[model samples]
Target: MKHLRFYFDVISPFAWLAFAKLPKVIEGHSVTVDYQPVLFAGLLSHWGQKGPAEIEPKRAWTFRHVYWQAHRDGVPLQTPAQHPFNPLALLRLAMACAPEGMTPGRHACEKIFRHVWEGGGDANDPARLQALTQALAPGRDPNSDAVKQALKASTDQAIARGVFGVPTVELDGRLFWGVDALDMVSASLRGDPWFDGPDWSRAAVAPPGVVRPPKGNP
Candidate 1:
């Protein structure tokens, strides 16, 4: 059986869409998926980059594109009451649901994703979060030091794996990013020779024609 690690942050609608479609994408294959919840903000900070929501025009385009993609893909998605809200609570809650030294399972991940994307509600509302906490019945305290540390470790691990974004799938040490890469993932899972071709290696080693200067220097 193949093991696939899905790294995500609920702050991203693309992650929600990818999570919803993943089961169908690997239906016939014997694949074990590990749902990993990491902080999107942490990733952005580590990479010295801003999220789509942080850029005004890209933020609008991102929402519009995701909604259209979700509709086309038959995945249910609703924008939360706010964009780019703090996801620390949800991330910690997910980690708290896992057993010691393990990641959260699909049930916990689905519940959290649904809570944010299925209803047009405030994901961070105090009452709603309390209700969600009760519903999850986490084995550990979400706010506990251990849970927070675990979440940080998970994000650090992701960064070490060269993950700079959400909704990434790691299979056999190959990283596939974006919801649109589902087909590529499926192909790889089926042992497609395209992955074995020279193009894959060549693309990675391709030289950049121009270099952008540092912010202050430019």
Candidate 2:
């Protein structure tokens, strides 16, 4: 059986969509999935990049695109009461739900993701969070130092693995980013020869034709 690492942050609608579609995407394969919760803000800071919601036009487009994709795929989706809200609480809560020395699995992660994406509710509303905490009965304190460290370690590991975004599936040392890559993931898992071909390696080695100056320079 293949082991797949699914890295996600609840702040991403694409992460929620990917989580919803993952089961069916790997239906016929024998695979174990480890759901990892990482801070989206940490990733953004590490990579020196702006999030989809940080740019006005892209934020609008991202929402539209995700809603369309969800509707087309028959996945239930509702925009949260706010966009780009802090996800640290949710991330820590997910880590807390897992046993010590292990990351949260699908069941725990799913509940957290659904809490943010299912009802168009305020994800960070104190009452709603309290209700969720009660429901999960986490083994650790969500605000505990141990839980915070665990989340930080996970995010750091993801950074070392070249993960620059959420909803990334790490399979056999290759990082596939985005919900749209699910089909490719399935194909690769099924031993597609294309993965071993020149094109895959060639694309990575291709040199950039144009280089833009640093943000403040230009």
Of the candidates shown, which would achieve the greatest lDDT relative to the real structure? 1
Candidate 2 lDDT score at position 116? 95
For residues 18-128, write the lDDT of model 2, one tens digit per residue: 999999978999999899888888888999999999899999999999999999999889998988899999999999999877889788888998999999999999999
Clashes of 2: 0
lDDT of 2: 0.92
State the displacement of the C-alpha of residue 209, model 2, in Å, after optimal TM-score superposition. Answer: 1.3
Candidate 2 matches the true fold with a TM-score of 0.97
Checking candidate 1 for backbone clashes, the offending pairs are: none
CA lDDT, every prediction? 0.94, 0.92
| Stretches of candidate 1 exceeding 4 Å from the true structure | none
Q: Model 2 off-target regions past 4 Å?
A: none
Model 1 Cα lDDT, one tens digit per residue, 1-218: 99999999988999999999999989999999999999989889999998998899999999999999999999999999998799999999999999979999999999999989988999999999999999999999999999999999999999999999989999988999999999999999899998888877888987889988988995
